[model samples]
Target: MKISQISVFLENKNGRLAEVTRILAENNISLKAASIADTSDFGILRIICDQTEKARQLMHDHLFTTRVNDVIAVRLDDRPGSLAAIMTLFEQNRVNVEYLYTTHIGQEQRSAVVFKVEDVERGLSILRQNGMETVKGF
Candidate 1:
């Protein structure tokens, strides 16, 4: 119903993103999905990984600012308007989505979306009621 996501604050500079990936690779942390939202000064690197706790610990040890939070991973049909349909469900339920990212898990006809919402529990309930399959892990 919920998945752990790590958000790392990165300074907007060359090799900063590489540093994060390098650290994760060195520690064997596999990324399932990732998204970066950036401004002029910094960026938020949001990632879903195979190992959440270890990734967070490694990032912290390497002196990177990181935070762990739960996001809903909803399984969706890989077709037109699939995302719009899900957005409609959330909108009708009054659940605000802060952000979202998509990933495919070895399925050509289906994909999963990770959504960060205002109320995770309520969002999950709404999505479930709407017949959306929510995944548990990356």
Candidate 2:
């Protein structure tokens, strides 16, 4: 129900993002999924990879500021309204979603949503009780 994610703080400048990707790629780290949110000065790069610990260490060794956080991932149908239904469920259950990102495509006709909620355990339980399948490290 919980997976490790590395959040890399990056400067908003040319080659910054590419440099990060290069560092990971050169080290043979494969990113399963990634999201980036930036402002005027910096950005937060969230990445999901199998070698999470190694990724974090590598980022640190490169002098990049990084933090590891636990997040929940759930599998959902690819059809329309699937996301809305889950959002409705979360809303009804009062689960505060900090942030969320989804995989472009998943096994067959499914998609995976990775999220950080205020109460991870509570949110996970709600998802499980609703018969939602949770994804493990990927």
Candidate 3:
């Protein structure tokens, strides 16, 4: 299954990140997981939230550059080599992971990772064949 990730293009400056968070907070949107990659001039803030479409629309209304991307979320065991095992499967399948972020879910001692890959369907297939569980929602 594919998860919706919201990516916001932010200018690299003081309080820009805070501003984004403030907007989301004002709109009552909660972030489940988030990651940011930055350069000298700008940054891309990627987030998974309970209210994805609403968050995207709010960002748009505020004139923040945004886009929705499809990413795969997998439930991983919270132990050494769990991620390495998954990476090996991806390597064997020729799936390129563009980027990824992880979050701990509940009290199950499991980690959830959101992966942005070159091919979503192929990656999902490979993960499934390897007996990995794909997380569907928050």
Candidate 4:
């Protein structure tokens, strides 16, 4: 399964991140998972929210440059080697992971990993054939 993730490009300055969070909160967009890759000048803020299209519109209205990407999330055991095993699977399948981030599924003690891979559908299929559970929603 693939999830819609919005990425906002922002300046790497103090309060820039806070400002985005505040805007989303003020607009009632709840973040399910998020990640930020920063450089000296700017940063790419990737966000998975309940209302994806609404969030994108809000970001655009705020004058922030943004884009939507399709990512895959997999639920796995929260323990050592769990991540390694997944990577191994990807390697065997010749799938390249451009980037990844994790979120916890509380109570169940499972870890939900969001992956940006070259082939989203292939990644999902590989995880599925290996008995991995793919996250369908936030």
The alpha-carbon deviation from the true structure for residue 122 of candidate 1, after best TM-score superposition, in angstroms, is 0.1
For candidate 3, the clash count comes to 0
Candidate-wise lDDT, in order: 0.89, 0.88, 0.90, 0.91
Q: After superposition, how far is residue 92 of candidate 3 from its true place, in Å?
A: 0.6
Model 4 ranges with Cα > 4 A deviation: 106-109
Ranking by TM-score: 3, 1, 4, 2
Cα lDDT tens digits, model 3, 1-138, are 899999999998999899999999999998888999988899999999889989999999999999998999999876899889888889888899999889876656678988999999999988888789998887
TM-score of each prediction: 0.95, 0.94, 0.95, 0.94
TM-score between candidate 3 and the true structure: 0.95
Q: Per-residue lDDT for 24-127 in model 4, tens only?
A: 99999989899999888999999999999999999999899999989999887867898899999999999999999998665466679999999998898999
Clashes of each: 0, 0, 0, 0
- List model 2 lDDT by residue over 28-84, tens digit each: 998888999889999999999879989999999999999998899888776889889
**Cα lDDT over the full model 2:** 0.88
Candidate 1 lDDT (Cα, 0 to 1): 0.89
For residues 1-138, what per-residue lDDT tens digits would candidate 1 score against the true structure? 789899999999999999999999998888989999999999999999999999999999999999999999988776799899999888888899998989876534458888999999999988877778898765
Residue pairs in clash, model 4: none
